[model samples]
Target: MAKLQLITPNVAYEQDYKAFYQDWQDSGRAIIPSVAKDLPADFAGYVQRLNDNAQGIGLEEGIVPNSTFWLVNEENNEVLGAVNIRHQLTPYLERVGGHIGFGLRPTARGKGYAKTMLALSLKEAKSLELEKVLITCDVDNVTSEKTILKNGGRRSTDEQTEEGIIVHRFWIDL
Candidate 1:
């Protein structure tokens, strides 16, 4: 089984963050928000983005630490996928962003990593006293939809984002 590690932002991973952002962008996948190549190079902007994203959702406190989790092959420490849980939820989050955000890296697309990562995240969310959590994915992302449903996510409704993207929302009660 693959081991998943929840990581906090720190110096050791400063470069790893850059690399993951770069690799994901280069792989031509739609995961992290698109950043200008130069923005990642700008340390402050990069750090701020990361913090803002986590903080914006209240993932910064209550023993949760508002962090990101990396799914890895325990045997080799190979990074596969990641899921980030926010400490708090917002209106937008309720509609789409959800309480947890996850994605399978290009190299590990499939193999049930996404589902496992989310299941683990849900456990953590429950630990923080979250009775239920909302998770959303693009309507077209069948793989992610299935992963969520497999984790006991019940279908809610498709909401249209202000950006015009249709997002499928699911609610998972602990």
Candidate 2:
């Protein structure tokens, strides 16, 4: 495999994002882009939303400032995953959003793309002056929890939300 490349949202996909969308769709599974913000009701809906933001085809509001997003690609330039990182933490963010989020496209899971993307994003966060970074994953999301731990994340605490979702919090010291 060629070296993986991670680029910001502004330079995420220079080619066809549709191709990446199609690849994921064809696989019958899709990994949520942590950087994509709110996930739509489902995958199909989310793809529509992704294209809209990707192509500037449409727009969304309240994106955090100084936040950077990226697409992870293969040597062939095929997008294998995506990630998002914020330069600073906010109130609600400190509890939930954390300092970063990430995911691997469905078709690309188990290939360690999310891990690579995350490590790369952490480096970027350090560049942005983050001394320690916080990341959270749903308690049941073993895959994500492992991903967090794989990136030097230590278990922080568990949070129970009003909506009832249990989140496992972790922090990485850069």
Candidate 3:
């Protein structure tokens, strides 16, 4: 197995990213970390958007500045997954969205990649000067719950969304 590294979104990884995107699409599941959803047709533009979002440039309503990273296998150059780290949280985020959101390609699931992806993301969160971060997963997402626990996340509470979806919330002290 190749070691994985987290990288910022860039045009250089366009092909690998497209494959990663397709894998999620083919899974017929709702993409996580909203940032990875609805990629624009123009790859370059999509990359630019991610970069701009990180810098708090031209943000949309209700959006906070966030950094997005691609988890890649350096040897094979495959984009295995992605993580989005929000610099700050809003009321909604405090309730459910949380500060960190991440997902792996369908084929990459259940192989400990999520743990590494998250551990790496926390480093990025620390670099952003975040002392602590909130992470949330669906109440039924056992895999995520375990991953969070492995990363030193302490269960704080569980929140129910307006739509009545139960979400488990954990806090990681960075």
Candidate 3 off by > 4 Å: none
lDDT of each model, Cα atoms only?
0.67, 0.68, 0.92
Clashing pairs in 1: 58-87, 58-88, 59-66, 59-87
Tens-digit lDDT track of model 3 for 1-174: 569999999999999998998999999998887899886889999999899999999899999999999999999999999999999999999988899999999999878899999999999999999999999998889999999999999998556564777888999999
Better of 1 and 2 by lDDT: 2
Provide TM-scores for the models. Answer: 0.74, 0.74, 0.97
Candidate 1 lDDT over 67-114, as tens digits, reads 555555656555566667767776666667778878766767767677
Off by over 4 Å in 2: 10-15, 23-31, 34-63
Arranged by lDDT with the best first, the candidates are 3, 2, 1
Give the candidate order by descending TM-score: 3, 2, 1
**Best prediction by TM-score:** 3
Better of 1 and 3 by TM-score: 3
Q: What is candidate 2's lDDT per residue for 70-138, written digit by digit as tens?
A: 555555767666676756667777887787877766767787777878898888888878899998887
Model 3 vs. true fold: TM: 0.97
Cα error of candidate 3 at position 68, Å: 0.4
Better of 2 and 3 by lDDT: 3
lDDT score for residue 97 of model 2: 75
